[model samples]
Target: MADPTTATPASGKPGHRRRRVRDLRAMPGFTTTAWITIVTLYLPILVLVAFSFNENRSVVLWTGFSLDWYAKALENDGIRNAAWVSVKVALFATVISTIVATMAALATTRTKKFAGQGLVFGIINQPLMIPEIVTAIATLSLFALVKKITGLSGIGYLMLAHAAFCIPFAYMPIRARLETMTLTLEQAAADLYAPPLKVFTLVTLPLLGPGIVAGAMLAFVVSLDDVIITLMIAGPGETTLPIYILGAIRRGITPEINAVSTILVAVSVLLVILLFVVQRRMQR
Candidate 1:
């Protein structure tokens, strides 16, 4: 009898070896780092949301938990006025930015080739790449020039500046969506003798709906939160929420500011949840 350990297949047969696959994704260090990063970044946001309900006026201390801050925030006239202004700016800026960005995206993506496309994209995105202070100064200077030349002043200039600032934020996602989307469906519609307006309304616009909505949301949020540019470009009685909050802080840290912050935080949270639910439903 042959020894068990020494047993072998027939001489002409080849030896078989199994290849073990390694999952790069399952690496322990990588997962640990990712979890750490997520926690580090989100912990402050979670704390902010949690403490917004704190009864204490102090941001650092949690004396007790109550909903009084929300009530006070609702009743505060200054906060309400600032919030209203911010809402108007965000709404107008979002609409104008969406329209402009959509046109820019369509122009860049649909045209086979266009002169100065790169230059145009660079100019549109300059605000994002440059420092806020630089943009604020430039906007202020331009506002001065416009006022000197036109001898006109109103909220319209503020709206235009906010829209311009928001254009890059709106353009990025819309342009990306356009690039990834196929043109065959649009071409097919045109071949079927569909009018240009009808083709855009029925085919292109429908497919681009989500991107447009997302871009609008982003532009609105940016406009709502902007401080420096708004401070520079805003006219009389055009104080936004962030600027109000800053002024409140400079004067003193009052329960009013805390109250206002809490309310804003709550609204932001609700918006996020609503967006998530809408996205999930759309996917389904």
Candidate 2:
């Protein structure tokens, strides 16, 4: 074992890196630590999924395996309504956030450096820096004021809140893609007398499409998983799936929640796979 109390001498040999790589398997407790970490992270999810198929009502006690809970989860009107609301909010938020973020990414990446560029970047990424509860409370206050002024309280407020919060999540991937992209194609189009709008739509946008899709997927997942902000801004009839899950959890744990959770996890995994596939194809 390497000395814990004393500083180890640094290796200056050319073959030192390969030797370290070969010795990684010999490190004390390496395999045990990795197995423990994996079990700690994934064991609960596997247990939940297993119990979700239990024929018995008790979530903790597993009986014979069955699919009744999934059927129940599907048939529950409250669950259906909440799931629909979540889907709607996620779709709208993803669309609006992706569009706005795409434009913002282009502006930040394409334009010459300006005096306020740093400030603009900071503002765009404020949500990532600040605690979400702070943003939620602030958004709630703003919504209340707006509602008072206009006497309106619809699901649009929920959509707007999600879109506002997800902007940074969507912006980052798009900006990264734009940064890595070469300007040769766009420059060639410009030299041939193509207008800026035409160049963006015909050339840049196609190349950026995968990144836009990835950003939209990320924003959608974030909005779907968000609880605090949705709870704060949600009206009586605008409950999303996360809000519904929170209420259900407060009441008690049930196999119904496990079924719903398993379904959501499956869908999320599928979307992630799709996002990766799209990005890989684009790279090819």
Candidate 3:
């Protein structure tokens, strides 16, 4: 009548039962499959980073290690200008998206649930759910109409496009932070006759800082690396780093291009690390 799974071993002690544990590592080919997947995903990245340090002009050929390509990429005026443009656009987009996302998160999390709340969430996350190409095409069409009406052309278009798509990226973390927060402190402030505005600025905003920062970093990274949206929205003379890299690739791959890509990968990794740290702090 004893359970088979929890039955005691024949040679073991009478009072203790040995439970069966599912060992994924013991499965046939599990280790090999995992290793293959890891290597397949990361081998190209490893190759790219390695070749960035190669002294050879050819990306595939192995030569002596050198920093010459990195130097060349930095010294290139086109790359410098494109990098500057990317920074400006990313900064603008991050600020705009973060502010809007924070406000939206506050409104949704602080109030009573209303009808159409699910629809509102769906609308907010529409860009993330839809294909990037579709968003890019739709943004292009919208911006084209605005440009025609206003007779305007500038980097502002690209900034707005990036911000529009980045809103959901910024919103998710802020909303998650707000949801995990306890109502005790805010209720205490209310009981003490603190106005809602004062409670938010003095109590809520400080508590929400980590989420805001994480969201901003995420938005900044998304805006920085956006190729499809940037390509569709960029005006004449508004080339960004990704676009620059694309042009360079069309010409041919070189160590300089590899160096630039490696730098971008490094930057993205750094920002993601910082974001992880902030999220950990929020958990504490």
Candidate 4:
């Protein structure tokens, strides 16, 4: 007997019923909403990039396209100094954060479940969970105390503060990579009578290299663009590029400011692309 649920329509040749499945993409206004969201997010950035090439002093006024602003930004001593400072801080922060994050990832992932493991993870990621303003304020108080007690002050303070916050950013990628890796290879190396240190040097380190690089790149970008923490930790004559940009904006937005911002955006985008490429290769 033919079941009613399987009954065919009048035009159907067989009793097979075709269900009408609705696709999310076919939903009303889905495409329009997606386009609107993308435009809203990126249009301002497009405008900023466009004005970076403007020849006129006015940022909004349309003028002939020129590279004069970029050239001026390069020649400006303040900009150059600030850029140098940013690079130095970012490098130090990247190194410190990457090393600490790598070690923390290995410790947490390679061991058996134990007491306080979740607590350890929480401590490592505390900075990320807390607001940047809170971290800045706490860092300021600590540094102020150290300065009062030891009277020691320099770019080192900024480097340490940046590294402290960058650790969680660096930790995430390394931990994810470690979790995805299988233990088979490491176990085989152990079966060959290889020392733990030798096995790690030849096997584990090579496999983990891409994640380490990705984490370092991410940490570098975070430290480079840091404003609030740097502002709080930096001493006199220790301005970074972001701080310099803040000063410039306060004075007035200029073509030079736009040019510098565009350059910064370019660097950040390039690093992020490289990080993505490395991770994709690691997946294979």
**Model 3 pairs whose backbones collide:** none
lDDT of each: 0.81, 0.91, 0.91, 0.92
> Is 1 or 4 the stronger prediction by TM-score?
4
> Against the true structure, what is every candidate's RMSD?
6.8, 5.2, 3.3, 4.1
Clashes of 4: 0
Model 3 residue 133 CA deviation in Å: 1.0
> For every model in order, what is the number of clashing pairs?
0, 0, 0, 0
How well does each candidate superpose onto the true structure, as a TM-score?
0.82, 0.89, 0.92, 0.92
**What's the candidate order when arranged by decreasing TM-score?**
3, 4, 2, 1
Off by over 4 Å in 3: 1-25
Predicted structure with the largest TM-score when compared to the true one:
3
Which of the two, 3 or 4, has more TM-score? 3
lDDT of 1 by residue, 1-284 (tens): 33322244442322231111134226668988999999999897777766767888787888898888778878878888889999998899999999999999999998887788789989989989999989898988999998999999988888888999999988987887788789999999999999999999999999887778778877887888898998877877889898888888899866667667666666666766765665454455
lDDT tens digits by residue: candidate 3, 1-284: 44554454563643343322334227789889999999999999999999999988877789799999999999999999999999999999999999999999998998999999999999999999999999889989999999899998888889888899999999999999999998899999999999999999999999999999999999999988999989878987899999999999999888899999999999999999999999999999
Cα error, residue 184 of model 2, in Å, equals 0.3
lDDT of 1: 0.81
Judging by lDDT against the true structure, name the best candidate.
4
Cα error of candidate 2 at position 243, Å: 0.8
> lDDT at 232 for candidate 1?
77
Candidate 4 positional error at 218, Å: 0.7
TM-score of 2: 0.89
Model 2 pairs in collision: none
